[model samples]
Target: MNDYAIEVRGLTKRYGQRTAVEELSFVVPRGSIVGLLGPNGAGKSTTLRAIVGLLRPSSGDSLIDGVPFSALDNPASHVGVHMDGFGFEAGISARRHLEICRLAAGAPRSRVDEVLEEVGLAADARRRVKTFSTGMAQRLGLATALVGSPRTLVLDEPANGLDPDGIRWLRRFLRAFAERGGTVLLSSHQLAELEQVVDEVVVIKQRALFAGRLGDLVTSDADSLEGKYFDLVGGASA
Candidate 1:
């Protein structure tokens, strides 16, 4: 099998005269948890959208498992994506929502219950999505991504709504997923949580800045992911 789960080659996105990203390139190796870090307006979302085939890159390619996402068959089984919006219907039950996703992905009905349990949402499976807390909603999004049993996950702001305990749970869940040989490419503003869980970090601001193992990049007792990131980006807040 190919070693890289995702490969972005010279990715560029533009909005009329404004350039969102220019000549960005990165890779997410198989069986690793990689973090995509950047400040607001750094084109992180744009890059991710391109990777999942939601947008066509202006001047490059975004590949999944060695092929462009648009070229894959049964893509849901290979690359699961949870972008900014959860895309849940407010009135529908969580269980029903997942059932729909499963059906669309050609996944078995059994996955609905299996993924709900995996994401700790089985107890609230029948509740309406409008009634779910922000944290619960985040878990539901993750469940939606996992319902198809994909090998790679591309999540955006996955930790946004979680509380302290929920953050801990997410950390453990991501670690377990990597341990099981799944590749993860996630973008988040939560640097501390990211540092605890990611094996590799890709820091960017409108272009490729730093892309490598977190350990290799921060190789001193006094150094930290946050410090290194600030040094690279000049104290800009995410």
Candidate 2:
């Protein structure tokens, strides 16, 4: 088994003449939650897309448990991913949508109910995706990812539409997941909210800026994560 759950070696992505990500590299250790922080267009999303095989890297590579994402025989079983724009058929019920994804991922049908309940969407299981509030939809998206019971989770702003209680629930859930040997990589613009959950921090300013334990970024009198964030990526722009 590899020491890290995720490893990116010089990963880069380019769009026409613009470079979205430039030789970015990082590692997510097994059983730890790491936050990917960056200003707008700092290449956080680009790097994540490359890692999950949503977009191919122009150069370099990323590996999940020592193997490239594309090489996984059952990818969902190894890594569950949720990007900012996860889409669901508006006409389908949440339960049906998860049922479909569960089948596609080769996960047992029983997992559909388990994940739905786990994400606090069981009561809305029969509701059409279009009828769900933003918070409910976010929960559904997380349910879809959880259906596979993946060892590693890669989520982009998973707390976007959640209420305070929901956010607290998510924090506890992720902490428990990591304690059970699951790995997590989360990216969010909510620095204060992020401070409650992540164990490590990976900050980027159109490039790799800092990567280390969250404690390292918190100096005396600068304990707030938001303060450390601005200090690290000041003047960064899209």
Candidate 3:
């Protein structure tokens, strides 16, 4: 199998006269965590959506582990995605949701319990999703993503609405996940939190600006990723 977990070449997405992502190309190697950094509406979400087959690009294509996302026989097994919302069945218990995903992915039942424990949701496994706090819901979303042991993870703002402790847990979890040879692609406006976790970063302004290691992007002595982001995007700080 190819070493790259994901590959995008000449990616472009346009809606009428407005272009969301333009001529973007990047490769995420196996076992690495890559952060997608940009302001709101900077095409970070759009790029991720296109990569995960949620949206079709006007040009170019994305490959997940050497197979085109569109052509995969079981796309969820290869690439797991978590967007902004949990999208859980509010009436179902968290454990039940995971069990459904496990059956669909053909994963062992043991994996359901394993992922719940991994995301710190084991205690709430039997709780109805409608009763979950935002952070708990986010954990459930993460659990769903991990249920199949997917080779690559595409998450847009996985940290959204998380408390401090929850954020810390997520950072540690993602770091460990990457360390275990899993690939991660995460998009977030929370650069402070991202800098603590991501190994590399892909910064997109109104366009594709930079793609490299995180340490390389923060060389300007900025105290935070948000500051560096503004500098790169040519926007003045408030």
Candidate 4:
């Protein structure tokens, strides 16, 4: 198997006359959590969308475990992606939503309860999704992603609307996931939250700019990863 869980070579995306991502290239090593950072309109989301086959790339290509993403019969088994909301039916119970996703992903029914417990949602399994707070919903989304036990995870702004305790759980969960030999690629506007979890980071400013280890990116002069991020991305905040 390839050492890289994901590889993008000279990737580009265009919408009409505007270019979203231009000639982007990066590699996400297996069993590592990589943070994708950039300001608003920096094409972070577009790059992820292309990788997960949501939006076709305008140029170049991406692969998951050396297999082209498009060639996979069921890409979700290899890559679990959570973008935006959890997409659960409000009236449905949390457990029911998990069952539906389990069936759709062809995942084993036995994994459903395991994932729910992993995400700390076991106590609320019978609660309707409509009553879930934003943090609860986010945890539910994470549980769904874990149901298939994918080799790679792609999450966009997962920390949004989460409280401090929830963020702590998320960081711990992601760290544990990576330590177990799974690759995680996450994008978030909250650099502080990411600093606690990611092993490496890929920063794009209008396009690809910096890609390296988290420690190297956040040197003593930089003091913090977010500070380095601002400097690298032209001091622009999303």
Candidate 5:
């Protein structure tokens, strides 16, 4: 088995004249939660999409457990992914949506209910996707990711619409997952909350500015994630 759950090596992507990312490299260890931090337009989303095979890199490559994402025998069984801007059919029930995903992933039908319960969506299982609030929808997305029983997860803004309790629940859930040998990579603007959960941090702005254990960024004063982030990336937004 590989020592790292994810490895992005000199990954680069370009769109005509625009460089989305350039020479970005990082590794996510097994059974650890790493926060991918960057300002807006930092190419965080692009890097993630390229790593998961949603977008091909113009140069370099990414691997999940030592194999390219496209080469995985059963991708969902190895890595779960949730990106924003994805929406379900307005009339589709959450349960039905999960069932469809489960089948497509070649997962057992029983996993649908298990993931629903795991994500706190069991009570809303029959609710139509359009009827769900942002928080509920986020939960549904997580359920979709979990149904495959993956060993790793890659999530973009998983806490966007969650309430305080929901955020706390997610923190606990991730900790428990990692304790059980599951790896997680999450990208979020919520620095304070991120500081509480992540074991490592990867900061970028088009390219990798910093990547190391969280403790490395925290100085003698115990700088906060937000403070250290701004300090490293500077006051600029992009």
Candidate 6:
């Protein structure tokens, strides 16, 4: 198998005259957790969207295991995605929603219950989505992603709605996934959480800025990831 689970090659995205991402390139190593770090409007979302084929790039390409997301035969089986504000019908039960996704992915029906338990949503499985808290909704999104048992996960701001305990749980779960040979590319506003979980970090300021092992970014002189992040992106914003 390839050492890289995902590779972006000179990826660029534009909106009319405005460029969102420019010549971005990076790689998520196989069986590792990589953090995509950037400030607001730094094209993090745009970059991720392009990888999942939600938007076409104006130039360059993104590849998963050497193939574009659109070209994959059974994409859900290989790449599971959880973008910000993933939606569901307000009235649908969480269980029903997962069942629908399982059918669409042609995954086994047993996957629904398995994912529910895995995400700690089995107890609330029958509850309407509208009644779920932000944390619950996030779990549901994760469950949806896991239903296909994909080898790679591309999640955007997955820690947004999670509380302290939930964040801890997620850290443990993702680490365990990587230990099991799953690749993870996670985008997050929480630098502290990223530092705790990611094996590598990719920083961007509307373009590729830094890509390296987590420890490399944090020099002996640097105090923390927040300080490093500011040093990396602070100049760009100013």
Against the reference, the lDDT scores of all candidates come to 0.91, 0.89, 0.85, 0.87, 0.92, 0.92
List residue ranges in candidate 1 displaced over 4 A: 235-238
**Model 5: pairs clashing at backbone N, Cα or C within 3 Å:** none
lDDT by residue (18-135, candidate 5, tens digit) is 8888899999999999999998888999988987899999999999989999999999999999888667888999999999999989999899989998998888899999999999
Candidate 1: the clashing residue pairs are: none
TM-score of model 3 (CA atoms)? 0.93
What is model 1's C-alpha RMSD? 1.7
**TM-scores for every predicted model:** 0.97, 0.96, 0.93, 0.94, 0.97, 0.97
Candidates in descending lDDT order = 5, 6, 1, 2, 4, 3
Model 3 Cα lDDT, one tens digit per residue, 68-89: 7888877768888889744989
Q: Which ten residues in a row have the lowest lDDT in candidate 6?
A: 229-238
What TM-score does candidate 1 get on C-alpha atoms?
0.97
Q: Compared with the true structure, what per-residue lDDT tens digits does model 6 show for residues 164-210?
A: 99999999999999999999999998998889899999999878889
Off by over 4 Å in 4: 235-238
What's the C-alpha lDDT at position 141 in model 1?
Answer: 95
lDDT (tens digit, per residue) of candidate 2 on 1-238? 9789999899888899999888788899999999999988889998888888999998999999899999998999999988887799999999999999999999998999899888888888998999998888888888888888999999998998989998999999899999999999999998998888898999986577888888888756648889988877885554
* Candidate that beats the other on TM-score, 1 or 4, i.e. the better one: 1
Better model by lDDT: candidate 1 vs candidate 4: 1
- Clashes by residue pair, model 2: none
Error of 5 at 67 (Å): 0.8
